[model samples]
Target: MSAPLSRPSYAAVLRVPRARSTFAAALVGRLAYGVVSLSLLLATVRATGSYAVAGTVMALFGASTVLLLPLRASLVDRYGPRRALAPMAVLYAALLSVLAAVTWRPGTPAVVLGAVTALTGACAPPLGPTMRMVWGELVHDRRLLQRAYSLDGVAEELLYVSGPVFVGVLIRFASPSAGLLLSAALIAAGTCAFVASPVVGGLRGSSGRRQQGKSPARQRGLLQPVLVAAGAGLTLSAVDLLVTAFAERHGYGGDTVAWMLAALSAGSAVGGLLNGAIDWRTPARVRLPWQAAGLGLTVCAAGLAPGPWTLTAALACAGAFVAPALTTAYLIADETAAPGARTRAGAWINTAVNAGSSCGAVTAGLLLSHASLGVCFAAAGGAALVSAAGAVVGARGTAVAAVEAEPVPEAALEAESGRSGA
Candidate 1:
């Protein structure tokens, strides 16, 4: 009989110098995103008295960010982190301030607000992907990198779960603007600190790391996994919207929405930790499709839940599969991309996620007007299944790419550090 593979330790991944500080700094900025979006949506609605208008405004922000993510990633790759992120962070914070001012003004046109929001989102740095790139730079071992990605997923889930509650409290006790203001402050502070941190590792190296060709998006076999990730994002956003719809349909309090969302995120965090600890011998290509399918099936079951508690439980179950699927997607993306294009690859995943979420929000809104809640849940399931199909179809290409891609050594990385503009 074959011996079992041992799992990687989270501690091993974090043992590198400056890892904790860099991770925490990036996390602050990421947490701000969770606060800003929903808070902005809610504030806009409160001011405009139109859910449609608010949603449109928020969607524009998400859309612009999705469209600009690759460009931003490319910039980061070419110019390095300090040059790319520092100015962008300042501008992003300034724009958020502008947004908050405009939102507070009564009778402000939604169109004008949306335009500003779009521009604001465009200015925001690709912090999440950039942080992952930092991880790839810092963690030399492939298994350690995998664990880092899992930890990233868990941190993101925690942020999404807690950020809303934080914003909710501020909105209830103080004002909706408070959340926006706080988010802006966090981004401004976090981005500057994160970009300037010595712990971010290095991006400039001449160890044959630089590629002289088209970006990863244009590369073969990259598009399908990106699309699959979009499907996963869509399902997640759909579930979020459905929870809101379910709360409103049943006349549940606003806090109920927070609890439901928290339940989902909590489950994801748990799953991520568990996933990171496991030593999976199977390739991501083999695991992703099954994980996505399972996520869909679980979410589909949520529609039939009889009560808030039941729905929360079902959503939690669905969330358990999310991090594993996302981890697989990231792995596949890294494998399929060119050496120099890893940052761009990570950005593509981020773009796909935002795009899918925006699309899901729109779809859920339409379904709520026409179909039953249960039906809407099934639609989310359908989207997840579609993602599964995409993953299955593209798995072979990524697997082949993985076999060909070589891991850069830690010594080579450090040697190249001095050459980085950052």
Candidate 2:
């Protein structure tokens, strides 16, 4: 038999010199998004002095963004990233500037704010999917690509953790407008730089298989991964609600809850890194259900913890399974998507996540009103268990293992291009 496969090192996988600038730029854009919903919510509340209006504004923006993402990704795939995103970047900035100004007007109509938010949401870039697609283009090795995604998962968690803090600081030291202004600036800069990067600048849509008369979007296996992603999102939101209720009930300070949440994020980042570093040799299809089940069960167990510290530990344990599950789902999406439709595929995964999170929050909230915290936790676990079932059933007959088993020629090309100094 051939030798056993060695674990892939993340350092070696990400050492693509030509890809660094693009990755960094996309990262900034992604991180900027972490602050947006919260900042806008705060801004809307400050302006209208009504939580209802603020909630409506934020909800519209989120829903619009999710609805428009597929279209945005399709545009990027049809045209090139540079051609598609550059104009969008400019328009997004202008709209944000307008929003900042409009929010300061006390008499601004809710409809007017809704329209602005809708337009702004439509303009939001598909940076997350774009970056991942670029990596698919830059790195051919399946193993290496997995590691890259792991890094991205870690970055995502970190950005979400710190982005709110950044926005809060800006709001504290400057004005409410400051957060929006900086977010606009960063998005603009990042989009411009990302589109100009060598790997993405002149890239065209993958029309090869489309010309051959097969559609990747219509593939049978795509729905499973999207469902899996949705399940992961649901679990996350459920846990968030659980922690919030736990803290409030126990008289724990907001800082304590934040630390507990931080521990979870930290565990996810660490798990993602470890998952990426080692070639577990398990197909994503096989890994996904187990990961989802693990997440659900962990969260359920956390509900049994007697104190904040115990809950924190349980959350961290649950978090460890989060990124690995997500990474697997993403990998599944990448593999199953039709050529030229990769961006839309990624967007679909995102859409599922958003929808699932909203559902999870609602479910947890309703449960919290009538049941003990443990019951809410149990429900969350049930949701995850359902997700795991979906994964198992959804992944039926997919050849993910065979695909990953194929030799990688892309990594060889990437290595020859240049290595990053990072």
Q: Which regions of candidate 2 fall more than 4 Å away from where they truly are?
A: 1-7, 206-218, 397-422
The Cα RMSD of model 1 versus the native structure comes to 8.1
lDDT of each: 0.81, 0.81
- Pick out the ten consecutive residues of candidate 1 with the lowest summed lDDT: 1-10
Predicted candidate 1 versus true structure: per-residue lDDT over 248-287, tens digit per residue: 9899988899899888888888888888888888876688
Question: Tens digit of lDDT per residue, candidate 2, span 1-422?
Answer: 11114445677655665666778889888776887877788888878889999888888898888878989988887787888889988998889889888886577888899899989998998899888778778777788889888888788788888888899788878767667878789889888888888788868864443532133334546777787778888888988888988999999989888989988998899888888887777788788899989988998898899899999999899989888988887888888776687777777788888889988888888888899998888888778888889888777644554355456777676777775232
Find the 10 residues in a row with the least total lDDT in model 2: 208-217
CA lDDT, candidate 1, residue 222: 65
Off by over 4 Å in 1: 1-7, 46-52, 107-111, 172-175, 205-218, 245-256, 368-370, 397-422
Q: Please report how far candidate 1 places residue 127 from its true position, in Å.
A: 0.6
Model 2 collision count: 1
Q: Quote the lDDT for 187 in model 1.
A: 94
Total colliding residue pairs, candidate 1 = 0
